[model samples]
Target: MRSDPLIAVEHVSREVTDSTGTLTILHDIDVALPARQSTAIVGASGSGKSTLLAIIAGLDRPTRGTVRLDGVDLFALDEDARAAVRAQRLGFVFQSFQLLGHLSALENVMLPLELLGRGDARARATEMLGRVGLGARLHHHPRTLSGGEQQRVALARAFVVEPQVLLADEPTGSLDHATGETVMALMFEMNREAGTTLLLVTHDRGIAARCDRQLHIEAGRLKPAA
Candidate 1:
């Protein structure tokens, strides 16, 4: 039998109000991200793909809806509780290679470990950097590394915590085709090794094709996969 979905997004919606009045970014979005599988969210820009990803990650609250991560109700939690859940269960990879400029690659990866107060933060960070083939560049800062290298550091950071789910948004958007391919390969390989579920948001059909399933969003609504 198949394992249960690790993420359940139920009737989610996101709206914003400004001078022009209310605008909806996501419309009653409902989907489940299955465990230990690669799933892609694909759509044109502003189609609410990223919004959906953020909500799943507990990075943003839906205007109306409930997101349950591992059967824990995320929306029911206070902000601090939600944040604690995020730190404990979710890992993120972003297009911009979100690393600290002031910190070395090793320090960057050690961040989550440090947050969890893992006593072996340095050792674990070092080992993860080696796994991503950045052992020699561990001391380098973001500005000193090539784009691909920086992205590798990001991958290291995301995997260091060994989270139950990985949330990635256009992780390859900032790199050239060749470099993106390398990083993506490493990402999938690590996910496999860790048995972590992958939920990716991207515009590249090729990348989506690599996923076990695809979620298509159009103008704030999700359509069944063709």
Candidate 2:
């Protein structure tokens, strides 16, 4: 991992208004994740872990403060510009394995590359599917694959772009224990091989333990991990 931080969060906070009143979902948070390192964000349900992840990924905006990804101030850009940066530099893996059910594995993996206008989209997608051990299942739809297989396809699609950072939210939350373990193992293996910085939000202590560092959040404040 490089000495420089790949992601920087400075004095960040978030709030939402409900019928009751304004509620703070995150407090003044400061975090720095080094390049090519793995960090886990751990907290209980509704502790703002997911909220933080979304802000980091540029999927949502924080009410206050700034987020810099590889020296680029994310919120400084307009939505379209931010999206372009995300497509080029970030990969996301969701717990639910968000694949288009109507598309085959190959097609699903090809979508991003296609959107980016890569001429060799088919070849790259095919190669990625093979890496995830889904070479033979390229034509299979998500519904036909096992949960592990579906997640593997999701992994392939995420890494196919060779993103600088990989962000995951409860990646194994929906799987059985054994399958979740297997998927996580593959995730780490691929992370190592690709030298991608990994920032994952997970409630599982075992998963958090595998990361280089763990950030514990409680009541929207970043706390030292127990």
Total backbone collisions for each predicted model: 0, 0
Candidate 2, 107-194: lDDT as tens digits = 9999999999999989999999999899999999999999999999999999999999999999999999999999999999999999
Task: Return the top candidate by lDDT.
Answer: 2
Candidate 2 all-Cα RMSD: 1.1
TM-score of each: 0.98, 0.98
- Model 1: lDDT of residue 40: 93
Q: Encode model 1's per-residue lDDT on 20-134: one tens digit a residue.
A: 9999999999888778989999999999999999888788899999999888999889999988888888899999998999999999999999999999999999999999999
Tell how far residue 54 is off in model 1, in angstroms.
Answer: 0.8
Model 1 residue pairs with clashes? none
Clash pairs, model 2 backbone: none
Give the Cα lDDT of each candidate. 0.93, 0.95
